[model samples]
Target: MDNNSCGCNVCSTREDLPWEGRGTDLPIAGCRFTLYPMTDRYVDIILGSLEKTDTSYVWSETDALSTVYRGKLPYVADAVKALFVNAYRSGVHMALEGQFSKGCPGDIAGDSLLEKDGEAPNAKSAEGIHFPVKCKLALYPMGVGNYIDDIAKVWYMAQDRGLEPTTIHYATRISGDVHDVFDYLRDVCALMDESAVSHYILHFTVNCNSPTKE
Candidate 1:
C-alpha cells in the first residue's frame, strides 16, 4: 500500500511528525510524525482560501502564486492587466511560455508549427491554447459515444451552466478555458459510446501550447 493510505498514527496524525519518522528512536523512510498545532495553522490558512471561492478572484498584480486553482488566477480584465504589459517591456511577439508545465501520458502541450511554416498537427492530436478570459463549465458525461445518442436530453444537463465559448477547440487546446475543453468532451463522449473505449479523462489549465499527440 502507498504511504498516503497507511493507517498508522504517524500517517493519520501530525504530518510534521518529521519527514524522517521515528519510533523507539529509529528513523523509518516513509513514516511521518503527527501534525503539531503549529503546522495545523498553515493547513487552515491554505484550506480557508479554497473554501472562499470555487474560482480565481481578481488578484492584485503583486500577489504571488506557488499553487493554482487555490489562489486567484491573474486577472487580465482589470488593473492586473498592467502587470503583464509592464512585464513585457522587451517588445515580445507573445509571452514566452513558462517552465510551469505538466501533461497526461503522451500528451502534447505547446506549439505545433515550426518557425511559423510547419504543417499543422492532425486530428486526435492533443493541442493546447490559452484564453484571455476565464469561463467555467459543468460537464456531464453522456454515456459513451453514440450509445449516448440513444439517451435523450444529455445536453440539457450541461446547458444550465450558461457557458458559451467563442473559440471551440476539438481536442487540441487544453488550456485557457475549461468550458471549451468540456464542450469538446461533451462532443467526444457522445461519439465514443460504442467504441472500444470505456472512459476518458479531460485535463485543462491556463495557457499551454503543446500538441497532445506525437
Candidate 2:
C-alpha cells in the first residue's frame, strides 16, 4: 500500500488508487468517551489487573466467564467507570476503553465482524443502539512497528464513509459526541483480532444506558 494521506475519508490531495472511497464512514456509537490520565495510572491499573489473569487461562480455567472476569479484577460492573472517575479527577485518559470489551487473550463476546448502520432517524426510542456492521480488522499482535500505521489506515477508511472520529482522549478527558461512543466498540474490536477472546465486558458508566449500564 502506498503512503497516501487521507482526511475525512477523502484524499485531501487527490483520490489515488485504494484512496477513492477506500474508507467507509460508519455511524458512531452512542454515549461513550476515552480516558487519558497524564501519569498513566488508570491504564496501568487496568492493564495490570488484566495482566494478573494468565494469558493462557484457557488451559487452566474451565469456566469461560470466570477467566475473563479475573482480568477485570475487583471485578466490578463499573470497572472502566471507576477508572474514568479517578482518571477524570486526576486528568488522564489512559484506558482507551472501548464499547465491546478488552481484547484480552481470550475474548469472544461480539467476536463476529459486524457492520455499522448509520444513525437512524428515530434512534432515540431506546436506551441502547445495536450497530449491525460488517467490518474486518487484521491485527499483527507482535508486529508493533506499524500497528499504529495500520490502524490509521483502517480509521481513515471508516471516516470516509461518514464514521467520524468522535474524540481524542488524553490525561482523562474526552472530546466527542454520542456517535463516537457507539463506534468505540467496533473500533476496539477492529484494532484487535478479538474473535479469539473468550469473554469480556464494556462499562457504560451511564446506566439507563447500555448492556453495561443496566
Candidate 3:
C-alpha cells in the first residue's frame, strides 16, 4: 500500500515541481521531446548527460516516451543543447522528436506554450522588439548524423544573418527580424531535404507570436 512502491501515476507527487505553487505568471518558454535511441546505450548516455546539466530548469520525465523542460528562454535552450551535445559525445546514434513554444494561443498548463506578459506585439513593436518564435525540429542518428550537419549549417546561417536563435530540446526558438526568421526556416527545410538520410524523418512547425496574444 506504500505509494512509493505502488508505481501509480495518481500517487506520484508533483509537489517538487519548480512551479508547484507558482501560477503561470512569469514570461517563460518550454519544450518537450521524445528521444529515440538507435541502440540501448542511449538511455545511459542521456541520463548521464542530464545529471551534468548545471542550469536551473524545470524538467519532467514522462514514462519513456518524452521529457519536458520549462524555464526562461535561455535556460531552456541551454539545457536542451547540453543534453544533445552529451548524447552526441557518447557516440550513440539517436533521434529526437519534439515541440517548442513561446507565446502561443492557450493556457500554459494545457498547451505547453511559453508564458508572456502581454498580448502579441504589433509590427511597430516587432520592428525594434525581439520576440519568441516557437519551432519543432527532429534530428535522427545523432552521432555523425546527416541532419546534425545540416542543422549546424542552418544555425550558423542564422547567426551570420544576425538572428537570435535558441535551441530547446529538439526544437528551437529564433527571434529577430521577421524576414530573417522566415528565411532561416526556409533554409533549414531546404537543407534538411537536401541532407536527410534514408532512415531519417524531419518535421517541424514555426509559430511566431506571443503566447498570450489575443
Using lDDT as the measure, the top candidate is 3
TM-score of each: 0.20, 0.26, 0.41
Winner on lDDT (2 vs 3): 3
- Ten-residue stretch with the least lDDT total in model 3: 1-10
Q: Write the per-residue lDDT of candidate 3 for residues 1-214, one digit (tens) a residue.
A: 2212122243245455443333343344555666555666766867776665443444445556667766544445445544544444333345455554432222244433344323222222223433334444543322233445666776677667776666888655555543355445435434543553212223454434333443
Compute the lDDT for candidate 2: 0.31
Q: Write the per-residue lDDT of candidate 1 for residues 28-64, one digit (tens) a residue.
A: 0010011111232444533343233222232212123
> Which scores greater on lDDT, model 1 or model 2?
2
Off by over 4 Å in 2: 1-143, 161-180, 194-214
Candidate lDDT values, in order = 0.26, 0.31, 0.47
Per-residue error at 205 for model 1, in Å? 2.6
Instruction: Please give the ranking of all candidate structures by TM-score, highest first, separated by commas.
Output: 3, 2, 1
Please state every model's RMSD to the true fold in angstroms.
19.7, 16.2, 17.6
Give per-candidate clash totals: 20, 41, 4
Better structure of 2 and 3 per TM-score: 3
All candidates in order of lDDT, best leading: 3, 2, 1
